[model samples]
Target: MWTINRFPGLWLLPALLPVILMTVYPIGHALWTSLHEVMILFPGEPFVGLRNYGRVVASNYFQDALRNSLVFTLFAAPSVVILGTLIALFLQRRFFGSHVVRSIVLLPWVLPGAISAVLWVWVFHPSFGILNGIMRDLGLIEDSILWLTNPRTALMAVTFAHVWTQIPFAVVLMMAALSTINSETLEAAAIDCRNPLKRFRYIIFPEIKAMIVVLLVYNALIAFTSYDLVYAMTGGGPGTATTLLSFQIWRESFSMYDFGAGSAVAFIVVVISAALIVAITRALPSDLFAGD
Candidate 1:
């Protein structure tokens, strides 16, 4: 009889079982469905090999969704990082009202995503919402603009909302990372006559580099998987300008009743996000977690 030793290694089996059941099984199921004409919401469909993949690859809707996903990621992730880092850095120092400011910035991260989305929907309302009213009163706009209705500004609006909701998370995370820096090390750099900017450029940035990269990868995955925000905010309208891949997948699966194509889209998104995370992890040296 062979016995498995109980260490941290024994915990791996339970952890892996859930991963296999929830993640691996669904992934395998989606991959299989992508290769066939799956009637997800109905019965009796014929198995068609690779035709769905070919169709999805050539479709303009898929192209548009992919493009929008990339554009949103490009803008939203960095905005959150830079803004969040600034907020974190500012709050790291002791000052009057600093605690209050930090709490205010963390509001979005505490709220439910659905609630935040709905709140923004009202905020951007063309007629009575605060945004347009303020803009109009300040003479920033000639008239109230239908933020979700206009294709040109729809992406920007959604991106802004996403950045707003996401920044709080980045702020707290990077702040925690910033707290781990050695004060003595910073003082040593100061003793060498390094300016504040130079200290950050050398000592500070290097210490938090891993956290920044991880945050980027995490935010990219979140942005790519985003559907609730886009759905509640724009609903993939006023001409599909703000349609993301997740919502597009929902449309294909439910609205269009094309399960095969939708499953393929899901698989592709997961693959792309996974690849990005793996790449970032590889770029970080092994010593990132090593204790001095």
Candidate 2:
């Protein structure tokens, strides 16, 4: 007699085995490594007991990298969400060549991050760059700006490039959410809500609110952990202007050959990212996860 109790629970082990090996083991290994003094050039891995963490916290580079990461997330995440929603709204309308336009919009997102960064590097070049040429034609400036080289503009340039790559993803998700909205409800609301802004506030927004929150959290996490763009474009340069924590980890581990410090930084990033995700999820509407 097949009953609920008779069901083979051990059958699920195969599915769970991969997750344990991939996620659980790596995190445990990293945590263990962070507690020891392990250097590539050194002969021994000694028990340091949080010394690496203390050094990482006290370092000026760590402070700069942390601040830069937060600043980049602040700028890049919201820009991706807002621009994505706006573009999604435009594409929602049926018009000639709309399909073509939608395909074109996804080109940036389809390209590899390193490739996108390289393209942006050329675009932001001080001389013979399209951006500068456009600005010059518009009479915006006579002198060429060092976009990636200048400390002030370097972070902004990287953020812009990140935003461009992320927006297409946001648009696709938003459009999916928007498609679920009832057209009759929108039409009914249009009677009293003649203004498009009012219609969105009253009807469209409430429908897509959950997706918006999802996009915010997803994009924020991506921006916080971003590495490829910074590595390819600026190499965290102009003196640490664009160095995020992810880049800091790479530099500490490979560049400086301090595996202990890099592991500590990596663990810090994991903790903070997990906390941020949890906090945002809790603070938003409780019904966000509710099923229709």
Candidate 3:
């Protein structure tokens, strides 16, 4: 018989090895690369000691990309979480064809990111797009809005698309959270508090508060690191309007052949993601993690 003390973590090596190789090794390599002058055209990878990081930070591109990323995360994360919660609540009601509606709602989540990007591109196309047509019919606008092309609206357009793709996941998680609410408590609240808003505020909100925090953090991270949608939709914009850190990494590494700068940007992204997640968790109520 295999004793626990005799072979500590031996059995776990098989599982842990792959994770170490995949995550640990890449991060280590990126960190190593970031400390050097790793231009692909250069003959040698001379040690630079944070020069790549300094250069990336000093660049206007990095500042613009950072601003855009923050804005995207701010808008997309809350929109996904709030819209998802509301939709999940509406779906909880027993109505005709509710099952079908639930399935349809998950369609966006199931679709590939590239495909979703393509679909949204057509939806937001400047000329002869569905959105423009609808707005025109409603007398909302005299001319089609330049969504992907114009710098002013490009970031918001991408954020809207990201929110759309993310909402199905948020809804699923919120639905599961909502399912855990005690029916008796809900019914009692409904009787005593006829106001729907009051019921949500006092009862429903408390029950799903933990899940809300989780969804917010998760969605924020997704928005912060999102690349495929931006790449496929706007290709980092008419200018640098929609350029995010992830895209910046790609631009430096592949487009500009500056591997050291790319790795530095990648490291910055990792640090930012970690810090944002920590800040969000710390700012929220401690009771979020309380055991029943």
Ranking by TM-score: 3, 2, 1
Worst 10 residues of 2 by lDDT: 1-10
* Distance from true location, Cα of 126 in model 1, Å: 2.3
Candidate 2 lDDT: 0.93
How close is every model to the real structure, measured as TM-score?
Answer: 0.89, 0.93, 0.94
lDDT of model 3 at position 142: 96
For model 1, how does the per-residue alpha-carbon lDDT over 1-292 read when each residue is reduced to its tens digit? 1345535566588889999999899999999988888875767667888888789879898899999998998888878888988889889988999989989999999888788989988989999889998998899998889888999989999999999999999999999999999988877988995587887888888898878887888888888889988998889988779989999899999988989989989988988788868976787778765663
Model 2, residue 133: distance off in Å is 1.0
Mind sharing the TM-score for model 2? 0.93
lDDT at position 14, candidate 3: 91
Identify the runs in model 3 with alpha carbons over 4 angstroms from their true place: 1-3, 6-15
Evaluate all candidate structures by whole-model CA lDDT and list the values in order: 0.87, 0.93, 0.93
In terms of lDDT, model 3 sits at 0.93
Which regions of candidate 1 fall more than 4 Å away from where they truly are? 5-11, 40-42, 188-194, 278-292
Q: Could you tell me how far off, in angstroms, the CA of residue 38 lies in candidate 2 after the best superposition?
A: 1.4
Clashes of each: 0, 0, 0
